[model samples]
Target chain A: MRAGTLAPGKRIRPLLLVLAARDMGCNLEQRAVLDLACAVEMVHAASLILDDMPSMDNAQMRRGRPTVHREFGEDVAILAAIALLSRAFEVIAIAPGLAALQKSEAIAELSSAVGLQGLVQGQFQDLHEGAQNRSPDAIALTNELKTSVLFRATLQMAAIAADASPLMRQKLSYFAQELGQAFQLLDDLIDGCKHTGKDVHQDKGKSTLVQMLGVEGAERRLRDHLRSADAHLADACHRGVATRHYMHALFNQQLAMFS
Target chain B: MRAGTLAPGKRIRPLLLVLAARDMGCNLEQRAVLDLACAVEMVHAASLILDDMPSMDNAQMRRGRPTVHREFGEDVAILAAIALLSRAFEVIAIAPGLAALQKSEAIAELSSAVGLQGLVQGQFQDLHEGAQNRSPDAIALTNELKTSVLFRATLQMAAIAADASPLMRQKLSYFAQELGQAFQLLDDLIDGCKHTGKDVHQDKGKSTLVQMLGVEGAERRLRDHLRSADAHLADACHRGVATRHYMHALFNQQLAMFS
Candidate 1:
């Protein structure tokens, strides 16, 4: 996939995760934390690769450059995507100092986010018959599968690594859900604006938030999701001064984007 | 991919691991064993998907059926392959009553095997500029990267799940190495024969065994590799009656094919 396409998106999820890990006392210098960061980024990268493939979005350009399929050919693009995903797992698995079992759980979590219950299924839902014209609920469903799960998994893995309590993890999961929705909404807007000549509003035919609620309603729901995301950061805020700072900065950045 | 193409290709590695697990006293039920078997098969399926992509072998047929890319478009094929891989992880990750972490570890192992150090790197080597008409050792380097690591990881996961001793796990790894070589050799023979008129000996040119030794020498090497596979299994053999029976049958079946 074109690095340029990925470059267009703010790497908000990974940055938050790295910050969260730091707040939870994970050593940035540790290979595991570093590996985790790379793993999350690879997931982000893989998503773009798939998104740009001829079937999914049929996108010609991304990040102001030709998509992977366009540049490398479909065969190389697909293998390259697979290669990135596999390497993400390898990097984490081979990291030093983490117990073998911890490494395993991390791998499992990542896989779950990408697999049937997650990205693939989400993509399938969009691709399935009658899905092209999405209802609001259907669009929400796609957003959850295609985007939110990875955001959720990212925090879950970092929190698990930091040995956070179950409650903390739950809070983080909620935050991820909201954050993911916000990100998806942003994607819809960008796709709508930039892909005017293409099938930008094809989601209107599928089960998408845009189809169900109209453009204005979808934007409103996005705000609500962002609010929840900010609210869920309360626990993190209470935990430590550094964490509060991170939460504030993250929220501020998101707020600016929405504005 | 056609379901028929994925029909039980000996399932040697997974069966060996489950048997090893039993021998090590893990005592999993038939259902659990079956699940692991499926997981292993999924890995095999995923490998086929990658192998058939335009960049790699660009093989149109697999196991006498159309490849995934042929059946579905390249994009769907890629997603389906990923779906299979993710499902395999799900099977292992959520195997009933197993520790979550253990499941995670198995997933990590499989992913690593498929990723950079394993299949991906192997594919990379095959696709590299230096790959064409390389020396035997260079070809071996690609084969080991592409095929052998996965072979080793399969046994290792089985051993880990079975709680086998570290020493025994080492033995299984050795067995897997030889088995992998034998398996690849068989692949070479099949491809060399079947694809002779289709294109250049595409996969064969990617082999070290063939380049260094020539086709006849490579044939001898394959036979030697199988012999070594038998020998390694023999070294690991012990009191497990079922395992012994299965291993004997497996070796005979594969050995017969080559003969």
Candidate 2:
């Protein structure tokens, strides 16, 4: 169960979580913050496990190796994914030194991110992206629901751990949302141009940012998102500028690759 | 998502939760208890969604109709099941009139029941049950983890909601475990003989109590479980007698069918 998550990966979710914790002036190594980071990473891995299943993407490789379902049988992959998901919640619930109210809040935030109106619905939309018209607004909504919300959840869980106010939480959510959109757009560009991953042509029917916005238009949107994320960070956290610097350094690498 | 759960079925788990709540002197109509009942039902439905997938049991029909995967396609079914799961936790986390401690406890209990050493592992064992020796202990452990633990979780969640004592919770766990084993054994017998549900013959390779013990022996063991459950209830609940009566009435109907 832990193999998929503990395997080599970028772990952007966990990193963002720790960054969010830092933004709130909390210790980066706070037990609750650390555990929540692991929780989101595990949840993210579980999602990938499902997304890579034969019935879904049919991808034979991920995280630079055979996907879980490919390495193990489909049965193990499914069970392991579920186990990871449940464990993610357990990690939050049993995190040492966390208050009960905050624990409950974190659970609620995570559940809301993954449940009916969040990842599940987003995945459903993505699956049908080919059948639908996939208008720019639809594509954006799909990206927001499918990707941004989980990112929002990562930061929001951190905010709860730090005892951040509701207003601060809202600003952090906006910051995460922009970051998530930019991340997905960069992914699409990479997949489209480099064909480094799965057969990108197989997903040709699905709408992508590069297809919706011309290459230049998509780059413009990515920059706009970065600026929005910067503004939200400045308003939301005491360490906003520092966080923005870290994010810019990270995004710049992707942007360089995109261009 | 509710559509899947609200579909007609036995709904024994949620029923047991409500009864357990009543046994603890809690109002069955309380919003928290009621929402939790719905939550358990939703989780059960979600499990069915996965269990019926072609990769797993390949069950074409469930709940007297086409299974979710068969009806809505595999991707939708998977997403819908996950949505139900997250929705279940959300229901508990946001449940009104519940204390933070109890809510967190409930989440932990439910997650543990569904996580690494629980349903996931149990399902893995079931897939390999025939490959292993299929000893009585093996079969029993498989049933305990896959089925009984969830039943235990249902009662455990109810105990938390009712503010029941540790001792009371332990007793309820035992009651649920025995009840769960008995329920599965009875189901095996029913499927073995009557063939009312899925193609039981197709599952002949799977270990079952009816196979280990003769039908008569399985029935005997079920009776033993009921007696054990009765003992636990007597020592556990302040209103044990009434709860026992309700269980007896319910069990009798099932026993008559099994016979």
Candidate 3:
């Protein structure tokens, strides 16, 4: 579990959670925020381990290292993934300073994001439909399930922690939806380029937005999503300069590789 | 998930939870008790799916049918297991009439039972050390991890639901521990018998109490455990006549097969 989670990688989901919590004016202790953040990251890490299994994506490398199953054997890897997932809920269930209702709500959100309506469904779709000729709507729905559900869960958990107004939570939900699409599109673009130090051509045979739109068209769609995401973020957190700046820098660093 | 969980089975863990809750005078709605019971059964079903995988026990049959992976492929089987586990937590989190603190405590107990200190650790030990020359104490610890931890969690969750006194909770804990040990030993004994209608000889090469003590000696130990468990149950629930009757019938049914 440590090897899969603590290895050097961009903890984008947890960072998004922390930033959103701060943007929502969450006044909880830093420890509470950090624990929630870690919980989100643990879920992400667990997904990656399962995804890289021989029966799933069959990827041999992750984070520039042997995948968990490759390093630890499949049984241990599966157990580690489960351990991480269970520990994630355990962390939130016992997190200090949060109200019982808040913790319960957070656990509900996180578990749903990992269950039938989220990662499991997303992965099932990817495995069963990636090579098939799929409609744009189908592909987008898959992307939403694979990426945005967790993003929505992350921000919604932040909203719960902060006791944000319903309207603010709605805006953040929109923001997460748009940002998650843009991020996945950006990843698709990166997968096609050889100079990005990533595992290139991962989507070589898959039906993706980039496959339908080409690199330039995909880039245009990505920009549209980013613009929409920024608008929602602005509406949700007018004074969230740090969040805006960090998102801007991160996207620019990846998008610039295309230029 | 449905195929794995809703299949015909004994559902001993969930039954234990329901019985314990009733014995503790839990006055929550029947739906709440049913939901909690289903959650425990879901967790048990999820563990069985993983344990039957090709990378683990390599078992081809479960509950008298082709194992999940054999029927649905390993990837789908894995996702189904995870979905079951996640849904278990979700059920508890959203269970009606449960106070937020009660929900949180139940989630903590259930998660720990599935995580490092519970199922994962127990499965790991079984996979890594099952065939080794382990000491009696080490073997007992493994049995406790694989069996008793969830039993303890089930009863503790019931205690929390009923708001039982700490003294009553302690007695239930002791009751669950002894019951769980006896339950595991009985399973081992049945595994060695050819006429039990079970998938016999599962522990043919594993280091088990039955292996160390022989069938008669193991039966003696099981009797001791059952006696101790009854004593604890008597202490825990003086008026739990229904629970005691059910346990007595279940055990007699299994043990009679040997006679």
Q: Each model: TM-score of chain B?
A: 0.83, 0.94, 0.96
Residue B96, candidate 2: C-alpha displacement in angstroms: 0.9
**Where does model 2 exceed 4 Å of error?**
A195-202, A240-242, B195-197, B240-242
> How many backbone clashes can be found in candidate 2?
0
Candidate number that wins on TM-score, 2 or 3: 3
Angstrom error of the Cα, residue A219, model 2: value is 1.1
Q: Which ten residues in a row have the lowest lDDT in candidate 1 chain B?
A: B191-200
Better of 1 and 3 by TM-score: 3
Q: Model 3's lDDT to the true fold?
A: 0.88
Question: Between candidates 1 and 2, which one is better according to TM-score?
Answer: 2
Off by over 4 Å in 1: A1-9, A22-31, A94-104, A129-131, A193-215, A235-237, A240-259, B1-8, B22-36, B96-108, B128-131, B192-216, B240-259
RMSD (CA, Å), each prediction = 4.3, 1.7, 1.4
* Predicted complex 3: CAPRI docking category: high
lDDT of each: 0.69, 0.82, 0.88
Give the lDDT of residue A157 in candidate 2: 88
TM-score of 3: 0.97
Which candidate should be chosen as best, given TM-score against the real structure? 3
The DockQ of predicted model 2 stands at 0.86
